[model samples]
Target: MNLHTWVAARGGIAHREDAREWGYSPSRVRAAIRAGEVQRIRAKWIATSEAPPELRAAAAASGRLTCVSLARRRRWWIPEGASSTVHLQVGGNAHRHSSQAVLHWSDPLVDLGPRSLTTSIEDALAHLARCFRFEEAMMIWESAITRESLDIESLRSVQWRDESSRALARSVRGRSDSGLETVFVVRLRGFGVPIRQQVRLAGHDVDAVIGSHLVIQIDGFAHHSTAADRGRDVAHDAELRMRGYTVLRFTYAQIMHDWDGVERTVSSAVARGLHLPPTERRR
Candidate 1:
């Protein structure tokens, strides 16, 4: 491929050495720069005008994107109202960076190669634990687990540097189908009721099961937007109800924005023994 196409294929930015290996000589690279096809970044990286701003900023600052910035790029679910600031991981000795960007100075959890413009997923999760609250960080981590197919046991074995990272590694079950599910599970941990996630019941995989008979289904917009999808969900809820399961469905807004109401409804259901089987409730 030609220089511009190659650069664009690599997300509109690439290392000079990678370009050379791809058969572009130094003179050719200089010609491309002179012709305004690509802009040189700190003598090692080059970017087209269409490059992502966060990536270009990372290259300019000689840092790798990490924390929520990288999580956003990877399409990981982040908490609402999380900071939009560009987060970069720079070497402890490096000094130059934009004041508006948040710079992480700690050592990376994994080594980044020369051509890498972003931190590894492990490093991103580590930084996230430090940058956000526990619940928010868990949301991102569980999203990563689902999106990246991360092995939970392997994650727990890593030598995470921070107490937050260690706690996250130990606590993450990796069973959440979405970040919202993770939030629901984490927030209800104190109920002292057994909670199982991704449980198969009535020939369908429900979101979570509280105690034994309480089936909680969380609907995210991406999955429940279409009329057909909503119809299918309603049918499933009817089937689950017919099978003696106490189904509680919550929307994305109710879970994220109206948690108090959601909690109260759930607490009432549990207190009334709706989560118990008929025999158990009668006893």
Candidate 2:
């Protein structure tokens, strides 16, 4: 195939022969950059695909497109973006790119498990945690799991420097839930609080179990609050308690905004109830 065909199909080309095969000399490649037929991918590369409008925006605006946006483009999973960070694959030794972007050059691309760009699943989920809010990360992480984004190889391929990050990546792939449930689970995980997602207990499917001690209920406050709702919740809590489960209730607002407090409460309760030494906790 011609150089342009090859580049467009490939998205990135750095070699000189590939440029020459496009019926253009090296000077012509430089001239085209000056003429604007193609945009240089940084100082040393080119996007042969003509950079789709969004990709161009992602490339130029942030120099890295990560988390939900990358997932959306690559894996087709849409996620909320509350000032989420975009990530690029600059090697650990690469100089920091200046673009108001929250760059993660240290975390090399491993294998997003056959994702849109073939980045590693650990890499993808790590990017999610680094760039987006806990809520957004949770949603995408859970969605990715439900959709099989977290293959064993991809999770194993995660690259991180800190022990916490490495640990989080190891376990992130197995948790999956609805969009809101995802938010709850992610925040819980972020704080290093143990949680079991989508567990069946007390004739109700609890959203999460914190260290096998407490059940976190992500109740929709909008629909709840009626007398019947309170009655149901109380009954559920009693049933769960009878079966050795502590019920920690959180509304949507509590889950989204003050998850730290929620985590503190749950983690403390878990530590006390499960007899886990405080330091043995993973967070």
Score residue 22 of candidate 1 by CA lDDT.
84
lDDT by residue (1-283, candidate 1, tens digit) is 6688899999999999999988999999999999988999887999989999999888888789999999999999988888899999888544474546899987777887767889999999999999999998998999999899999989999999889999999999989999899999999999999999999987789999999999999987566367887788889899988878899989889998999999999999999898998578854
Ten-residue stretch with the least lDDT total in model 1: 92-101
Pick by lDDT: which candidate is best?
1
**Candidate 2 per-residue lDDT over residues 1-283, each given as its tens digit:** 5345556666654344456765668787787667655667545455655555444434443334555556665653454334434445434334454444455564445533211222455565676676655456556666677776456556656556555446555555555556667666655555565667888876878778777656777774344477987898789889987766667777767666776787677777766664243445456
**TM-scores for the candidates:** 0.94, 0.49
What's the CA RMSD for each of the models?
1.7, 8.9
Residue 68 error for model 1, in Å? 0.8
TM-score of 1: 0.94
